[model samples]
Target: MEIETRTPAEQLRACEALRRTAEARSLDILCELAEHYEVSEDSLIEHLVDRRIQPVVPGPTVSEFLSLELAGLLECTPLQAAAKLYSALRLKYRHPTLHTAVQQLDIEPHRALRAVDKCAHLDASVAERVTTGWLPQQLGLGHTAALNRLDKLVVEADPQRAIERERARRKDLDVSLWGSYDGVTTLSGRLEDLDARYLDASVDRMADVLTAEHPGLSRGQLRAKAMGVLANPAMALGLLQRAAQPALPDSEAPNGCLGPLCGTIQTPLHKLRPRLELAVHIDTNAVGCATGSARIEGAGHITLNLLREYLSDIDVTVQPVIDLATVAPEDQYRPSAALKKVLLLAFPTEMFPFSNRATARFMDFDHTERFRSGRRRQTRLGNLCPFSRRPHRGKTAGVWDVKQHSVGVLTWTSPLKYVYEVSPGGTRLVDTGHDAWRKLDW
Candidate 1:
């Protein structure tokens, strides 16, 4: 299977020889060579014929071939190997029709993988029905809708089994906040409906008050503050007050006062009142649907029920996420609010792609608009264009086409037309993993 290789100079000479113009003179020489070799012109061009038949040996299954490719292409890249391995597994088990849906329906591979995961536990009929019936139709329904439809189909096929499975899932419920590390405490476990609702309300109420007083808190900080307040609002306030005051002398220090130099002192940063202005995109249609799924900025699944319960005490402003469009010269200032919210939501990390560092709140808004200069049409996003501006730019500087993804939760995403990603730096951008958002090199 090994093919001989040639040096660049040798390849160049070969290319020049082969590319000698196939005009009459060139053709005459080629014809003479063919005759001397006892071969016809058709035989000389036989390699170009399209193969309607499968290869004689059929090389290998996609999974096997990809494995070999991965070994060769990613010899030292563990991360890529792990990622591709998952894809290979999916490819191995993926039904032929699912592959067709991916090609014809334009479903992204990751999304198709999700659909595959759903039906993985069920019968082939379930996956087939979804791939054939719902996936192909771009009926303005986002991926959530298609998934929901598939779930409904699953239930209709076997209700008792679905209910039993759901009940079993409900049993895995517990609440825990592990010991703190680096001033961060991990919270896990599930809650009952009433408990979850109460917790959300408590956090929201505290977050509203905190955000109002301190307007610059990012969503994570706001949430942490809210939860801290919920744990013991009175004690939390007292601690804040103590931290705000200057440190006392060694002996004069209060009984519990660790003072300004305390390793964990975070009152100053908290007092600044960081904003929790996260942009959550959700499909409006999926919000209340039985099988609808929502994500809080890409922080895993946040069902509408949970989102409503969690944000009950927090003020929310709903706005349309217009499509990417060119800003007309006539419109004066940019219509900033909506676009800024969308960009921040999409790029929560506020990262400068070049620096590979998180902005933490210092990043500015950049508009990489479509079609300018001497190039073909390009994406209208920050990464591609060398356009960076302060956080709050003109209201509508680069709006060309306004597309509205359905929902607006914390880190909202349209699983179909667009995919949102949360970077290691905590920025939420479109999942540029696939060819979907080539503007971002991620």
Candidate 2:
């Protein structure tokens, strides 16, 4: 058979095609061609391309190169394998101690490689054992240098312990845990017998030192003491519920009826309910207050503030609806003649002009000195009805008399204190006071 002597470029292209074919699982054909040509694979490859071909691929990707490298190391002493692995890893991750420590060990290259790989994922102490215990002991590299090298490896592997050690090195220093809550309630306190199981094991572990100092108490007692220390309303409610169980009699029950005490307990917990908290704030402002619904954990402090702002001065009147059907058909269904006062003296007539019907009329006096100069002033038209004091006989005054005295004209008024200017620091009273017809700002 005649073989053609191809040009350099043609040879290079053929070599590349062959390399691709080899990668595609056709290396056996290349091997046969090299054998038939009576030339080494490298020589055949070199003839095609002048560039140096790597004898082995460095890492684990190609199994053939690893096998070749492993076999090469086996020909040398056990220490050589450790040294090679150390050198390889050092080059990869730039660890200075790896090479030196591997050289100092007497283990065979494969044994050292296996040991190091086994301990690679472990923490420091175990990694050190690979070097000191397994490598040196088995490979017969018994030397103080090997032990020292192992120690260095251990130190390099674990940094958290080093940080703790450095922390302990400082003297007269204080370390404390600080918690800030946007909405979550934080509980911190000492307990006589905190149940190790009931509480978070992490938190319990943190309080272990304190718990040890105050021993001889049951877990429940410790938890109770911790609750007492924290004075957490939620925790107290939980404890109360636990105590209220029929199986568990209240050993430390306070001197009071459980209903009232439970009501008192519920007062704070209920206040913690976001809707109830918002409702209370609304009610305080003579506003329409309603807790549509609430989700405990989902509610945040920001939401609470927003709810307060919305309900600040809003007023809503809920008239009692008389059920006429329940009454006798022939009987007169006369509603109560007394006008129900929805709001009265509690309303700030000075701040909010709308508190009184008569004062609300003067709200049109916008250019008054009290309004212009921003002074605290009170309204001249009082919230009291005409019949509240004395009945007026004049025509206009008679209108007020009829409205106040007649049962059909019965009306309720809501009085409110106006806030002209809210202070920057939220200390409202500092720059706010009463003025005639309008609340003033200093």
Candidate 3:
């Protein structure tokens, strides 16, 4: 038997009959059939209605159709497509609700049409979940125009850890204020334990004095003036004392707990300020030749005694020599051997100046240069005495009168050896056999 092909209308009627039968069995069966036929449940119901087959239950209403489309289950009608677009946008982004999500789309019908189109081919469950759960909330985004801005912010915000690291780095910069102190300058060790209270009191006293001196000054301006005055060490000490007094529990007990505070405050001041003294000496050989003999008689003896006293605690031997060769080599004479040896014991052996012929030759050359430079210029003798103006009869000698100028050459022979007393507290040069009143170059 040959089968006849059905017309379009007849085919539609057959599909509707099949759908009704499926619906009568179960809605699940109808849904399954809709999926198998690649048609929406709403579309299948519409087809059945067109064929004059009444649904067992009424077919989905317009609103229900829209809802199904929005949930991404059906996609036949334009109204349903708009609902789907709205639902998908709302659920995908959590922050903005469905209403806000719709408003964000801007383009009226086009936005709605796009949402439905995007959801149409997706699986029913997947489309529904994406619409309801993920797309509805706004991810802090206002519109498509604002998307680029949000993306930039997200990229920039990723460096929070680096910013925190930089903050920590700034804190470290604040902690390293202590300067180095290893004896490369005059301020080493000496300023290590300065007194702060003394400095504070000194500054206060200065301020009071300046205020009394000028009554018209404002307090702020006065403070600035006082700071300038207190830069002096004497004034600084007074100011430190004044600042520390209130902190002290008692006047007599001021030194007790203030020890560490003194160190803490004074460390900075010590670095800012320093105390210094300078001495210069000029040695003249002429003066030495004339006075050296007389000075040496008493000075040498005094120096020897000073050395003995200075070295009392030290185990090293002290020997005084009138001739340099006795202590140094014959060919290599050292003028500062005594001082060099003493310093060598305290410092490194390599720092000592060794006795050498080159040094001796250099000293001799310097002496010769000084002598040539110091010679007095001669002036011509005008009109010799008539009795002695015989043109110097037999020998014809030239008569010239020269100024008797004294040539003083200074020779730095060596550092003087003197006894000096030292304790943990301080050091002082001793006056054993020498006159303590006489000041010596150090």
RMSD of each: 24.7, 33.7, 45.1
What tens digits encode model 3's per-residue C-alpha lDDT throughout 1-442? 1235457668888886665443233322333322232213232322232112211121221222222212112312223343333333323332223224444442222332344334333444443444344343424545553334433333343456446644664554321112212211111221212344564455556667567667998875676666665656654654455444444456455454443334234334334344422111113343334232111211111232333353364344334423312332112222244433322222211110121111111121111111232233211111101111111110021111111122211111111222322221222333233455577442
**What TM-score does prediction 1 earn?**
0.32
lDDT of 2: 0.32
Q: Which ten residues in a row have the lowest lDDT in candidate 1?
A: 391-400
Model 2 residue 405 lDDT score: 22
Candidate 3 lands at a TM-score of: 0.15
C-alpha positional error of residue 339 in candidate 3 after TM-score superposition, expressed in Å:
30
Model 1 stretches astray by more than 4 angstroms: 1-94, 103-106, 137-140, 172-192, 208-223, 230-442
Q: How many residue pairs clash in each candidate?
A: 41, 27, 44
Best candidate, lDDT-wise? Answer: 1
Residues 201-288 of candidate 1: C-alpha lDDT, one tens digit per residue: 7676566657765799986688787786656544455445544454555545555344543334444433433345544556768755
Error of 3 at 214 (Å): 5.2
lDDT of 2 by residue, 385-436 (tens): 2211111111122111111122112221111121222111111221122454
